[model samples]
Target: MKTKESKKKRTEIQAVDLFCGVGGLTHGLILGGVKVVAGVDLDSICRFPYEANNAAAFIEQDVKTLSGKTVRKLFSERGLKLLAGCAPCQPFSTYSRGGRKSGINEDWELVASFGRLVREVQPDLVTMENVPQVEQHPVFQEFLSDLHGYHVSWSVVECSSIGVPQTRKRLVLFASKFGPEGLSISESNRRKVTVKDAIAHLRPVVAGQADKKDPLHIAPRLSDLNMKRIKASRPGGTWRDWHPSMRAACHRKVSGDTYPSVYGRMEWNQPGPTMTTQCFGYGNGRFGHPEQDRAITLREAAMLQTFPVGYRFLKKDEKAKFSLLGRLIGNAVPVRLGEVIAETLKSHVAFYASAEKRECA
Candidate 1:
């Protein structure tokens, strides 16, 4: 291992990523000069990509089982203890197929458990990301209440405003026990990056064809019927514009009126639809390319999440299928958004450390 001097030169601080899925947030923190000591997740499939892209160990264990001792050991050698987590947000996602109800959902319990870990380990700082609906959950409120002595701030943020290139919205929370009552982050006023800005430069390759230099830049294969459907789909157009024969059965039903975004094509100049776990499926959402004939690929989804073109998620020899990779990338917090979280925490850390110095003097 490198000496402390080299390690400190490499990163501003160390963090532990809880519920880390394929390391999107972890990678972002790493890029912002934070050393991620470990990434924890329940999904075994995340191991390959999480470890490959972020120089951190992957612990395929449920966060519910995380112990204070284990968490402290994760940082014992480095004297670093900054905790960051994006818990499983299915229960609070607006896209939840299951309607919202408090007592019935067990996922709410996990958030409290996450709080327990924080209260026990007592990290210098904490950061969390989740769907906007999470703020409405009582458990989330309770978690904030538990941090009574800590400074906490949370907001519903539009990822597109932060250059994510997708119209995803999320709730970001930052807490520091030693800083000001709350850290303020100004909303970005920069022009939104559209789907065209993200993927227009890639050479046009048919479905299943990899880019000459980047093997991971391959789109998924569509079925024969889907191929015919995509041919009829136009940028910013929906199946409503398609021939009658190409309409999905659900689209033909009365209830489908509420779900017109599916089987839809993206507009070139606008931000892409909020990427979901099944973004690889053209019929799942507005996943069809703005002009390309294929659905959005894993590489495109990662780029929309603000991952670099050279970021490696899977090894060359790995099967590295799109279905799983798509889930990892689509469900991830856009790394750019994570950078905003890092910046917020960095400011608070700096402020508190300065305050402590003045007190000692």
Candidate 2:
């Protein structure tokens, strides 16, 4: 009865996800008991998975053009309005910014547009998650300034501490009209989830082989040279372990020799490395399967990101493309990370609602 009561109270908090990519965050929030009303994203390909996996409507329009009143109308059904998003991180991410400054380019404007909607709608609560490098930009300061009416709490979150199976760091921000005490993220007490914990159930498939039972379990075909390289690769080993004859020409270069994460394999007992847009490729990062002589498949990557094993990245009869699936799964906010954020929000609302009840009594 107590669990049922808490779930009912959690339903009082409603949300709309901005820049919602294939509904990863929305799914996690729903799993955490938050009622996610709708998700908005420019990618039409996301529609099937987003709406199919979550009860939320997938709004397929560029957020840069979306009006706040339009969003407010979506929230008019009457619950505590919560606006959530992780603006596409290309402009703010350290890996891809290419020396670009904030508040100047069209990419950076997306973050500004996020701020615009917050100011216009004045939702009761707001949250944003992105790469840690975003904290250095001036536009981030401006976005922070937009929250003058709300108490905001933010920090660089070590995602693995909160049950995510990856060694990823994110800048998480929580703002609320309720008060300051409930705005912080809380890490779970569970032991760190690891690569073995996440994907060991998957049946072994060699490179270029697709599982008959699951289509998305397919690994991309490896080139002849790369095939030999992966065969020689040890679990948790880098290119440095490769015999000099099999090393990439770049790996033999002075600067490249120092860089070792690429062409590496994940350790079974440890958390996986941060996932990236190119995560499907074996040489892209530490993406090789620990014992299998193939790159980690799309299914493995998504699982490492804490998406359910049964997640539908493609529709029935739709062929899976490595590049497209990689981008969608990699760019998604880790489902476990989103779960922690949702848990934080739920606990916050319960505390304040209880306080109000006591005061009224």
lDDT minimum window of 10 residues, candidate 1:
91-100
What TM-score does each of the candidates earn? 0.88, 0.93
Could you give the C-alpha RMSD of every candidate to the true structure, in order shown?
Answer: 4.5, 3.6
Q: Which structure among the candidates has the greatest TM-score? A: 2
Those runs of model 1 whose alpha carbons end farther than 4 Å from true positions after fitting are: 1-12, 76-80, 91-104, 355-361
Q: Model 1 over residues 8-36: C-alpha lDDT tens digits?
A: 43235679999888788988887766778
Residue pairs in collision within model 1:
none
**Winning model by lDDT:** 2
Please report the TM-score between candidate 1 and the true structure. Answer: 0.88
TM-score, structure 2 vs. true: 0.93
Residue 283, candidate 1: alpha-carbon lDDT:
90
